[model samples]
Target: MTNLTIIQQSPDPEQVAERSRTRRSIADKIRGMGQNRIGALLLLLATVVAILWANFATASYEAFWETHLTIGVGDLQLDFTLHAIVNDALMAIFFFTVGLEVRREFAIGELTSWSRALVPVIAAVAGLALPALLFVLVAMGSGYKNAWGIVISTDTAFLVGALALIGPRVPGRLRVFLLALAVVDDIGALSIIAIVYTANFTPLPLAVAAVGLVGVYFTRYLPSGRGPVYATLSIIVWLAFLASGVHPTLAGVAIALLVPVYRPDRRDVEHALELARTFRQSPNSEYARAAANSLRESISINERLQSAYAPYVAYVILPLFALANAGVVLSPEVLQGAVVSSLTWGIVAGLVAGKLIGVFGSAALMKITGMGEFGPGLTLDRIAGGAALCGIGFTISLFIVDLAIDDPLAQNEARVGVLAASVIAFILATIIFRISDAMHTDVDPGQTLLRPVDPKRDHIFGSPDAPFTIVEYGDFQCGFCLKASGSIHEVYEELGDRLRYVWRHAPLTQYHPNALAGAEASEAASLQGRFFEFERGLFTDQEHQRPSDIVRLARDLGLDVDRFERDLTAPEVTGRVQDDMLDAEAMGITSVPTLFVNGRRHTGPYDAQSLIRALSEGPPEATPEPQHPGG
Candidate 1:
């Protein structure tokens, strides 16, 4: 079963219950600890309080986040308000996650292979350019004309969830279409954040941020092969940019480049597996044991070296971020202002109109231009209908609005615009999805969160209740896999119980000469729950196969290499590795480090930073925001 247990240390429940009602009060508040409505409501309350303070309270909103405080860093005096601190400092972590997500998608997920990614890339580029053009056209000479780039974003989580709420009536194409369009929209929004939203740059901070960006250029080739270190460094760079007055979120894009992007070696994999097999199938003699022990040690080392730094950003950070920023206060004034604001109109119009123009126009233009055509069973009406639904830019838009305009009027209007347009687009998309279903006569799937479905039922992977699955496939000799030991530790810290990664053998025959034997060694570790340790050994070493490497790594990680070796080359265990290789080959895998979350393929040469992002995005769209309290 998937690990869905809510944390037992549910917080001081009785205290909150006294402050509110019972069902809606206590349980709600407890639920709020991890981002249910209570948490969002609390955040909303805080934001409202800030607004009240700014507009009416004895203290001002400026006072809440902007209270000037002086601190020392060597001889430099660092002065910033509480607001700037969060926006400039804390927000960098948020951007780091973004960088992780983008990196993974480009390397493996939706964008890695062009055959699968072209549609979205093309759509994203088009979606971005058109919205800016349309916004400029719509506002021509209006008062809030500077916010054109903000109009193109699509909040993936909100839109996709809404799409699921109404179910199959929305066609598969609609969801994929939205994903492509939204991802494209995200790239566009980031560009805008980088170029237009930030403050007048200070040279020192700008230089720092630049230096950080430069680090990313070489991150894919870092010698440490550690994902978390990369993530941490990425954050520092982001802070530098933020301190320099650049919008903090651009840091997410900046950090993504720093992650290592190498695939597993094939020859190393084959060499390791061959020795492992000979040891496993040999008679129960002294020579057999020695052979097994010798081969096992080598395999163990390779696994350990490759596993660190893989999980932190995927669970704790991303989920927490969603909760912190999704809250919005709803009031008559907020509504009235949004109704009158040009920023609101531009976004609403741009998403509603620009999306249609961009998506439909591009699809039609592509078809007519003879560059593209709908896959077998799609129609223009369905395509345009899906296009119209692409106006759901809630999450990314909200993030940008905070960065672009600090004014209360502009912020709320943008929120209202996102909320309104997203709702309308969702409804329109849902209706169109259902219409498409009728035409296709597909089966109807019921909606049930946290409920298990048959694995074959097309519902296992996205369920909140799905088991924490960990997947690993490695070569016995691959060094990068050997280095992943640190990455996995970070993932465990952030996710605790909600994470499950599975291991699969993907010993490539081309390199890592001992790769297959290494796969067998790790499987044997599973017999004693020491697979984690065995994996640690593989990824840490970059050097070629050494007989004592695995044993040494196992000892360091606290495993009995004697028993570990016995199992590592055990006949059935070795057979299991062989079986996995066959299975991976059947699935069209062309590389050594192939990974799958649930069953979907991992697309990139993942470091911890990128893998974590892919895992947390779940079924949520390319972009996600936390659910706020009221609306």
Candidate 2:
């Protein structure tokens, strides 16, 4: 007998099932953490601990946060208490992350176009203005009318966390809208901090800060050492702002706004790929260094800095800020005083009532006047619930209290109101979402296509008037989507002209980094009348859809490579992909390779035989009533 015997054993089905279950569990946990639910819980725990410490061990709580620290080089030194360090220094990083997000949205995200941004921008303005107005109305005679700035901002971290805890049935569109609104709210709050609260008017230091900001802006053109340059300039700006007696945290925002943000350039991506190939073939230190640097340089500095700093800001900085700032003594005297304090009632009414009415009313008015439109499935009811959640203002509200009110007793009263309002907002939002979900219980959003297939806009692979239709919401980088592509090909072959197959971009960006790039590249290719061909190329090499790889595919298919590169970032191309994604979201299609036959969603295995059977069955019978409960 030969020593080498060919033998293969099939894997156990139970083991496979176990692995799948394990993967799903891990994914769910990761998703929860990414949504900042864990961070929010940590913040809440910190606030509770601070409150308990302040009540039971008031002297120790005060002593601990009051401990002073100093840092310096040579003759220059800076001294601050632990609480000031948390509020002034670490919080700058938090605000820097906020500025990065704002710049990104303006450059490439939801606010890239006026049409898309109108509703959120108007709503955010109203959300800010109305809260301040309400606060002033109630607190005008309380000797703290100037503290109206305290309620104009929403705490984004808590807002997102509250939504996660509430667990709305379909919160995708609503969450996006609220996040957009929060970004604007942050701008308003930062403006108030800079314009309304600054006490000193030192022109020399302000001029120095402006120079540092200009230096930071020019660092993007540097061929190397931009990171160190940015770091040096940012420090200078922070120190200048601190010396000027303007809020030092605003310097963080200034530096962050100056950081360049853009889509990845084709040339830069190709250069990186070339370096990567060299490193792979040579396996040398020099090539490795070059390849790493190239890859890092391909992504915009704004995005890179945001990724580097977001985790620290969310998990460490914000939690530490809460611990330092939320230590209000809730004694019987304070509670009784707060009950009669107009300042307390003003904060509650501003955040709770003003945020709800302002945000929801503006969005509703925009819709009614046809000034702007909401994303699919972002119903007025969901917007109302989201607006209620926006009332949970904690971080900035407390920070503003410290700045806007000097009296310890008044600060304590304001803290109580912020905490109480947050709790009330969470409860109110939960109730509203529950009611909305219950009212729409008869509608199953995931079972039907929200948008009809349009030949002029969609990527179609067969005759437009085909008797049978198959539409797929797919991600280019998904392994399952690649498999589904093969099955779709088989179906096309079997049905010939009878089948009209459509591909809609539903990139699961959380899992697939290159999926959105591939989607945009395909849309770009579609402009040259070769969408299906480029799509087939993407599926053929699903593992390598990098920017470089996409451009190479375009060249291989004899496309106008230059125009293709330009079109890859064209607003129309990006919008086309976004439209498909929004439609998929409206239908609650969270995963890839979701199929629809005729107009009804097809659920189950999407093999060629199964899909063909689905296509043969045709569209399901329509109910007499309309499907959209919100409509």
Candidate 3:
């Protein structure tokens, strides 16, 4: 082929895509994108209303927002005030979009290719980790202990909206690059909300969420269904999420992952449009008859369905989120709080500092060391500005702050920081880009965001040197014993130095053929000062953790094999195992996994909080409330 015939690139590859943007006139395209800004405007209006209501408006907006509204029967009633309803319920849809965006970016967007993706993905890691560290450093042990999570999340909507105003200065590539970066940032927010912070579980709401999940799978993923009735099922899922003690906004992300995003086939749409016009013609005429014949032959259900579904996703879902959550009351107190608060400092520093140190720093270092490179049209200055813009931490920030700090001052400070950083990042990025007379940067991202290596699931107990006993009874083949890993982990997270878990074999002879040998292996591990490591594997390995696997695990944990072997077959080992089981039996601990919280009994289904409460409350302790199963 002639060099002249070569086509280096086309933004939209003429292939059918979901809500596909046109590459017609760049200026016109930007303008069209602006129309999409209705979502931003709606968000802004909501923020304004919320702020005015919170600070100055006559009625207590704060009280109205925070007040619980109950639904259903006594004790069965779902209690959530206005803020919770909006934050958890309506926000689920927002999370669904987040899920969709994350999915799509990985599927085809800038995140689809790794070489191009290295910079942003690595940068996102830096962006997420550093800000989180900064917040933790400042908030921990303070009233904001619950709020360490507040600083880590980056709000993409607010970030992008800021970018929009910086028009002509930011290039298309920068926009795509910043978008990919921020989307990953959103995922980080999700991780923090799910893992680092959560309250004790309550059953009803979680049960609702589970049922809603069932409904979603039946209609959306199951083959035996009609098209997803996203409305009713969506509401059900939202309700469940609200009740589950989980921030409900995540429900949106869950739905987005499960919801289908494909546009109806264009060819099918064309054929159906023709059939609709013909259907308008009279029924009697021969031409009408022919039209009817053609129409019957031409139309497809999927095509007609697509036509109906297009408008809802394009207009409704997103705009609603913006309207509900985007209200930022601009007043002197809010502004002053931003200046005086550590949340404000942490946020501004984390973003301004983190993006610079994390994204740009890593990118530059990687490039210099021959490890990574930059997206097209991006200059160092632009990158710096882009980093600043990423400081936009609204939606996720609000969600985290809700969980992180229960105190009013800290929460308010966090809110102020989120608003101010978003605004400042937007303004700074706009100014820098305008100075260079550039608009948007372009990038061909090539990889996906990297999820962290899952930590050792086995419970890590008392440090390498400590003296406390935790007797864990087990049958090698028992399912509960197999499931003990997570249970042990919760305890460890709650009580680190005060205890260590010791394995004992109560192996119901009917269930475990080698239970005796398993206990011996654990005893052997103790001989080599690596019993804890061996116990962790003994519990966590999903498959057969045979006596031999215990040896292998010990070796991996740096045990002295010679001593380990000698201890495994020690004469008194089997009896030691039996004695612990006898103690458990006498205590009426019918369960495979149970804990003695400083000589107090805690049986199966006991989490950290329960165990802690059980320990403290035992021996003339206060009456304990009923335990929530998962909580």
Q: What is the C-alpha RMSD of each candidate to the true structure, in Å?
A: 19.3, 8.3, 27.1
231-314 in candidate 2: lDDT tens per residue? 888899999999999989888898888888998787888899899998999999999999999999889999899888877877
Better of 2 and 3 by TM-score: 2
**Which pairs, if any, clash in model 2?**
none
Report the lDDT tens digits of candidate 3 across residue range 190-262: 8778666756657788777777777765674443234446667777777676666666677777766654443
Better of 1 and 3 by lDDT: 3
Reference-based TM-score of each model: 0.52, 0.86, 0.55
Residue 379 CA displacement from its true place in model 3, Å: 3.2
Candidate 1: count the clashes: 99
lDDT tens digits, residue span 241-358, model 1:
6577777667766665455443233334446566667667775576565555444444322132222212232233333333334344457787787777667778888888787777
Ranking the candidates on TM-score from highest down gives: 2, 3, 1
Off by over 4 Å in 2: 1-35, 73-76, 454-457, 460-468, 477-500, 508-514, 536-549, 552-559, 585-592, 604-631
